[model samples]
Target: MQSIRSLAARRLRSSPSSCFTATPASALGPGSARFPMAIFAAQLRGIKASSKLQQESTADTIEYSKLSDEDLNEGLQRETSESGARKPFNVEYLRESMARRPHRATYDFLSPGHSHLLNIALWDALPLEARAGNIPDSPQSSASEETSISQFFMPSASAPANNSDHELPSGHHLVYFPLQRPISLLEPDGTDPAQSPGVPFVRRMWAGGALDFRRPQNMQLNGARAVCVERLDTPNMVMRGGWGREKIFVDVVRRYGANVADLDPSPSMTAPEKLLALENKVWDDADFEERRTLVFMRAKDDVPEEDAAEAAKKPKAEERIIKSPREPEYSFSFTPTPTLLFQFSALSYNAHAIHLDLNYCRNVEGHRDLLVHGPLTLVLMLSAIRSRNTNSQVSPGRFIRMFEYRNIAPLYANEELRVCVRRNVQGRAGDERSVSEPSARWDVWVENNRGGICARGTAVTHV
Candidate 1:
């Protein structure tokens, strides 16, 4: 049996959500499918040792050395009120509160359309424009045991090669993740009272968040020799409540970019010409036309139901069916299942009822099936690009400096999801000689079975 601490670490490595472990799938009981009895055992025997390891790895003593005494006092004053009784929110204090080992996440983007039937199946899985009507009639729409993914579980050491030739897509880092202290550390009355103070009636939850994409990441280059730092500024906290429930809203800002291998580092700059190239990649002519068509269709959809019916009864304008773009430079499709959701939830220590409770999702949340984790889709997108970048011509040491994304819509279980990325047009002025210092950008998006873009964003890379 794996030690509890090791198992927790393994689970954390696989999913960035929270630190919760699941019993082997075989151990799942029909009645206890949603709530396994094994998790009720409160004592995690090896957690103490693991806590020590975390402390040793994440202590901020060295970082503290870089701060001046005056600045240090300011941070302290900001963290504690005048008498040091009430805890004032401090940026440095918050960063120190959430500390853990550098995160690593790995994913295997199972290929689509490998088998003959699978191709037809994948075609049918796409949204209308993407499928291009190639789906054979009566082709199997159901998933089979053979089609299930075999490598959903990723270990820490399996972290995708940061030095790969292909630049990973924006928003890929969510595949692996971050932390809060152990339960014992969070409750002063428990183990080490001196380490943490207890706060009765305090509740915390992951409110939603957003990412701002400043530039693309060069997957072709590696960042092993580069120094990367993520700065988390203090969050603006707001309080709101109604219907006997109160919530705290936290708005945080995080900035991350790469620098040279020097002891003192600054933002690694990208060449202006490379930036121009990335900024220039636009949709092909056909794609632009297709988008206009889709936009028109969408506009008609917004008409009131009564108006739509009347419009349908009247003479319609000539419909222009614009041909959509075919295969992109990088594409991968996968079916997310209940098991995948459960594993992800367990790995992230998420107990949100809507994710696992069918009744809640259907009755309370009004979702058709268990909802797919939104972050999971972004991870799949980035993973596909990373997989492609491994074979790309770009050099190593190009790391993803920033990625920004938002959920345009919700995704459900057992849906065939597609991730696609195409390099923006090359710079007109720069020759192929600038390949080594290439600054590339990609138009990245995730499409549904109906070929509708559910989420769209860009990935920029610099060397």
Candidate 2:
């Protein structure tokens, strides 16, 4: 058999530059320029190469490093064909599953108590100095205010029954738990398998999501009724690594609107008609539109044993750490305790084993400890943005209009997590006027203790 290096050299000598061109450091932007070419190739194809490959191939020692993108994909396709052509899930079943949708709109009352509990949980998780501006004086004077507390938390005044004075803070809607399915309906990982592709593609991760706040004032925390209309888009499958490492991406779209009976007050409306009208109204006049992208992969056992062992042997500090490109205008560090994770899981009604059961995390998921909820990181990023705005020169009246984020890696409990926010400067270097205009666009990220950016996002604000 030909040695990997020799084969690589032969390919390099025969292949034209057009077949494989090295991406320039400038093209990759700032911090990403430090990554190896092999890593870049992996990222370009959305393939997360095993840590063993990453560790073994240093800047000076990469095997088959000059393989063209086409060559790599061809090899993957060849391997897939050789693996017996059996699919994990039936395509017909998947199509049937995608065709199904909830017939009625689900409703949840905007409870101040739920938001208050989340506020307290987050406050307790932050350091004393980090909590400086988030103190609540009254129900309406808490974090969601433009001036007083952090804009991420609901005011204490809103916590009382029948209080509809305060608006629900951005990202606080996560606490208004979703309707739960029967215990027997949950997947082995403790996730609701309602919209899942099927078995074997069981392990789920929140890959990324986007939130659009159209009318923030309409989503009040006044114990008023609210409706959420959810629908699942068609799923797309991608070959992340190889046959066994395949991943399915599912997009969930949720629209939130106030459940006011005045929309259609005809007493003659039937039950189904009322529900249909409510859903239509929610979709047409949604106060908040959210898109959540979830990626599902095979269970840990399905991964090659060699790869799993190599991952287990790797030190946490040595794991791939992607640094932030810009310095943060505001940064806050907080260590997530087991109790904090439990509280957040309870609040979100997420029973995922990776966030709760240590044995499952270590033995099954191959994680060192319980993982932090992905949505929790999103909340932290939003909070950091609000906190930075409170202390910075940005206008207090401005609110987050659009926010989008991607989760790159897992964050574990008992580890220090830092939320960083920086003002986004647009336009060319000579254009000071554009760069200095209140920085309506912002860059936000969450960093682990090792300086690895586990999650990164962008936020657009409007006055």
Q: How would you encode candidate 2's per-residue C-alpha lDDT over 137-184 as one tens digit per residue?
A: 343354464554444454454444322235666788887736446578
Task: Tell me, by lDDT, which candidate is best.
Answer: 2
Candidate 1 lDDT at 431 equals 25
Alpha-carbon local distance difference test for all models:
0.36, 0.61
Taking all chains together, the TM-score of candidate 1 against the true structure is: 0.38
lDDT string for model 1 (1-463, tens) is 4443365446544432222322111211223211111111111111222345434534534575456545655665555442133233333442333221121111122111111222232232333233312221223334443432322222122224442322333443332222234664433211211111112113222222333332334211233222122211111222233211223332222222322222221212122222212212210000000000000011222335765576567532112212226557877677877877776565444445556778767764446777666656655544444443442444221333223344455566777767887776433213232345555555667776666666655454443
| Candidates in order: C-alpha RMSD to true structure | 19.8, 15.4
Give the least accurate 10-residue stretch of model 2, judged by summed lDDT.
Answer: 17-26
In model 2, where do residues sit more than 4 Å from their true spots? 1-96, 127-165, 235-239, 262-270, 303-318, 390-398, 426-439
How many pairs of residues collide in each model?
A: 26, 3
TM-score of each: 0.38, 0.69
Count clashing pairs, candidate 1: 26
